[model samples]
Target: MLASKSIKMSKEQVSTFPNADELLDRMRKMSEDESLWKKSKTDSGVDIFEGKVSTKYRQFRGVGYVDQPLATMVSVVKDAEKRKQWNEQMMGNEVVEDISEHVKVIHSKFNGGAASNRDFCVFYTDHLSDTEYIDAQTSIIHEKCPVMKGFVRATCLISGTRMIAESPTRTKVFYLGQVDLGGMVPSFVANIVNMKQPLCIARMRDFAMKDAASSSSVPSSASTSPQEEKQNEEK
Candidate 1:
């Protein structure tokens, strides 16, 4: 018997194939090439994010996919442009101009909760930028905003799960397919994806539950995420 730890586990069992080997073969045939997602490549570059986004039908399920909407993604590109303008004006430097130019538009029609707006914003700079980063790090509380000092975050956020982690290119779930995440997935996958250790299924359930809570299909705030909003709220 399987472990009884699963939530809402069904008594009905699933026994496909004659034996273990057959099941393995079936799974193997259905599985995608591991290498396909191994490269940890960025989607379009700037739209390196994929989370839950609303569609014509409002979803209460938290199972949103990342990086799959053209119009929404293009908006993100435009938002990056605005932020770039702001950051450049602040820095008086040509840094952060071309940071998120390749944001892709992943289509998220049936993921349920929201389409995963997945993409990456890699800021691999040279010595000057690195030095400025160190300066900001040293200042800590004194520093205004990290981006103000020429740092671009490579972070991921699930529409429902919230922020996954930072700097870890490609999501682990990007390996296998992700879950439906119910309706309320917590809307924070990007922050959550970068976590060193993976969260148990129970935790994922919680994220999905949160997504179910905020069933409003209304789009979230502008390019700035809920995290950014909270940070601004605190400030």
Candidate 2:
């Protein structure tokens, strides 16, 4: 199981991910640059784009919409453990630190099929406000985190996500990620990452919606556990 430790820090003491604001800006700019993105293979409403970031590496970006509340979408992103449940490529995942409710560090490994298996330790933070747009970013940061001996360490150089409420029950999401695979990767393996973005958003929406339905369907009288019921009877 993933373990977490939290420490309170003053606003000035909190270290922001380096250049996160710039990363978010780049993400927004890329999201609107539809001239670069190509339609994804999936029919799930996500658009995907890929371009060379450097001579040796390429980056991917994706945009999509989900018919779920902003809070539900944010919950999906913050629940790192739940990712392994839906993302087939995620072989192992754990949270190393909970800086606070809005910040965390996670270590995850992925199976790239024929490509080299890769792992990364990333620092993620969420910036949410009622009037300001919801935004988050994940960046490669050095920490005293454990590493899997066998997997190659991939650098999640910088990734940003932005979510905007479209209505009371809908949101627009944009994701940008730049990863260094550490070695040559097959075209097919890369394609899978590019195409999986939309599907991920869709899956999150489905899970959140179903959980909301299940919760709403349960009777309030039966919401308590057996232990709580026994304690109430004793009272």
Candidate 3:
């Protein structure tokens, strides 16, 4: 449990959390080592795997394909507000500090039904390239955010999504999460929840599909009249 304090740190101070490159290296190693994980089940098109780690909570990974470009999928993951709309468990998410254009300190709250609510303060970062996109986050102790009265402070050991561009319209997605939801949560209950965690990838894929559909439905700039384009640009 974290002490109740309202201390704020400078951006330089918060930036000391682990960077994206190091975390990406770890993610690659974990994902590539098949011996460390066992196939759990497949939901929709996503295949879920469960593995043991240093924490009491098991680490789960989901592998699947989404019918959206890497860039579009990246946009969907990066949009924090949009995430809350699809993730029913997410109660709140906000940026606590900006470490860089790609790295940030994020504070997120979750609704733990039948148990106390949970929250986490983590360092979030992402890397995008022509071939692959990686977004990762890990627990971080920030003075600005502490365990509130009604919530338990949870630790996000390591979690994120990795997307590999398969084609202009398709991407291979990998989602991993290892979190310690600190409290008296029973092992059986935790295991059940962890098993379903991978379903989130399917939800994400559906969300991205809808977003792509909506974007495609909008009129392109080329279809707009010169006057309308000028007015849109002016606005």
Candidate 4:
């Protein structure tokens, strides 16, 4: 089972990790720069793009529309406890340290089936607004969570989701992920896995839609007006 540990850190301690603002800026630029991305493929109405990054592994981006309110989608992604509900391979997930409302250090373990299990410790941060929400994360070293036995430590070069409200009941989602599953895995297998990373968007959409439908307290439509959605789309 996954659990969270609360650890209070001063501003100085938080500054030791990579700057969240800088990561957000880089993600925004990469997502917008058409020159950096090439058409990889499209699945289930989502367009996937492949691009080069600093690592040997390629980065992937998926753009699509989800039939759920922006807030519902955001909650689905941000809630660590509910990760296993949508993530098919997730074995465990926990917050190792809470840096702030927008930032935290997380440890996640995955089941690799016949192969050895994999895990990662990442620094996560998110920004939310009425029209758009951006959450970005990169792998980081944390003392509390070290490379554990029986599991390979994977590296998340960069991964996040960018969401824009399109209407009262729809959202435009952009998911970007670049990860190196460090091990003796064959390149062909790795490539195949990387190509399917974008499918996570669809899985998230399905899960969020179901959750929203089941919850009576949650509204089916967002409060954002059509004019507001249009203005956000323009920006």
What clash count goes with each model? 75, 0, 0, 0
TM-score of each: 0.17, 0.67, 0.81, 0.80
What would the per-residue lDDT of candidate 1 be over residues 1-235, giving only the tens digit for each residue? Answer: 1111133324243111123233233233222233222232233221122223333222111111222222222222224343233222222222222323321122111111233322122121111121111000000111112322222222211111112212222121211122222223443442343221122222333333343355456566566887888999999
> Candidate 4 at residue 220, lDDT?
52
Query: Between candidates 2 and 3, which one is better according to lDDT?
Result: 3
lDDT of 4 by residue, 82-101 (tens): 66788979987789999898
Superposed Cα RMSD, model 1: 23.0
Of 1 and 4, the candidate ranking higher by TM-score: 4
lDDT of each: 0.25, 0.62, 0.80, 0.81
Error of 1 at 76 (Å): 15
lDDT of 4 at 166: 96
- Which candidate has the top score in lDDT? 4
For model 1, the superposed segments whose C-alpha errors exceed 4 Å read 1-31, 34-97, 103-172, 175-196, 200-205, 216-235
Q: Pick by TM-score: which candidate is best?
A: 3
lDDT of 2 by residue, 131-196 (tens): 224444553444456556777766565566777788878888777665555545554554456445
Angstrom error at residue 87, model 4: 0.8
Model with the higher TM-score, candidate 1 or 2: 2
Which whole-number lDDT from 0 to 100 does residue 55 have in model 4?
40
Of 2 and 4, the candidate ranking higher by lDDT: 4
* Alpha carbon deviation, residue 107, candidate 1 (Å): 27
Estimate the overall C-alpha local distance difference test score of candidate 3: 0.80
